[model samples]
Target: MPGPTDHGRVLVVDDEPQLLRALRINLRARGFQVATEATGAEALKAAARSAFDVIVLDLGLPDLDGLEVLAGLRGWTAVPVIVLSARTDSSDKVAALDAGADDYVTKPFGMEEFVARLRAAIRRGAASASPEPAIVKAGDVTIDLAGKRVTRAGEPVRLTPTEWGILDLLARNPGRLVGQRELLTSVWGPAYVGQSNYLRVYLASLRRKLEEDPSDPRHLLTEPGMGYRFEPS
Candidate 1:
């Protein structure tokens, strides 16, 4: 029986029977609903059919490669996945992370540490599960996307049409990367797709109006050479 706080539903994917049984017993004893799959195909099917709080996946699978399964999962779901593997090489860890794994735990790990990691991953997933609210509050600033309004410290912040467009797009997709070219083409016309300077200028103006410190933005983030991500605190 699970208590109020014991709401974690975990999916463990591994080909090794002994490891699966051990994890199932330990996790279930700790009041986690545990589901196990022996093959990557089975794991994919199980994940598609159910809603899991977190996933513990083995890199070495009998049918499909673990990375392939990870790619498949990332295609439709944003579920948190932790990679469990015997490969100790840094390249393997990097590959797994690049393929969308939330965390990587080398094999022969301590049960206590693994459980702690599982808890942390579940916490992160839960935090990012919900979309941004209608009125997004970040530090001293608040953005009302639906109302097309921005305020800071109880005062309305004035913004141009272009600035509002950029802020609105970013606010709608919190914690997800919005590419530069995508932003330009969407906000401006397709002819302005390569005009990266437009973003730099508009973003600076946006920060000045909405951020407490224009030079160091908190909610508005830039992934150098890649894109921007809006993080709501």
Candidate 2:
């Protein structure tokens, strides 16, 4: 039985029987609720069925590639996923991250390091948790953070994947300034920290979609050279 502050539910997706068993036992002993799935299809189905705190996924799966599974998961859920794979290629790691994985761990990783990474991911998730009014209303725009949805003027508003990523990050903090570097790295990965232009373009698009006046935005406020803030009023 885990204490109140114990790590939350974790889903482990891998085809290796021995590895799955090892992870299950270790994670359970460490106070994480563990669920295991051996195939990518099964993993996707399991994820759709249950809510998980974090997902530990193997890149090599008998049914589907791990990146494919990651894409499927990202289609609906924003649960943090840490990819565990034997592929040591930098491209493989980049692909997984682009597909929305939170972190990547190479094979033969130490349990201590892996657990530490898991804790870090869980901690970030906890820190980003919404304070109250899970559904935030800003002007005519309604943001349902838990449901990963945004609507404007009583109708659903469509946002690009990148747009949603940025909005979600800002909405999580609610009226707080989310710095440019933090927003870039968190949404587009660390390699994109220097790409401030990307933020400008996407933010423009978001305003057009969500704000009544795109020229002088109300909800999505830019703090000159500092960062962006979401005003949920």
* RMSD (Å) per prediction: 5.5, 9.3
The reply for model 1, stretches above 4 Å from the true place, is 1-6, 88-95, 127-132, 147-217, 220-233
Give candidate 1's error at residue 163 in angstroms: 8.8
lDDT of 2 by residue, 1-233 (tens): 12475678899999999999999899888888999999999999999998888899999999899989997997788788899999999778756765667788999999989999998777755655535567889998999988888888889988878998999988877765666766898899879977889999999999999988999998999976656889987
Candidate 1: what lDDT?
Answer: 0.85
TM-score of each: 0.65, 0.59
Residue-level lDDT for 225 in candidate 1: 62
TM-score of 2: 0.59
Q: What would the per-residue lDDT of candidate 1 be over residues 45-129, giving only the tens digit for each residue? A: 9999999999999999999999999989987897889999999998787667656677899999999999999988887787667
Query: Distance from true position, residue 117, model 2, in Å?
Result: 0.7
lDDT of each: 0.85, 0.85
Worst 10 residues of 2 by lDDT: 124-133
Pairs clashing within candidate 1 = none
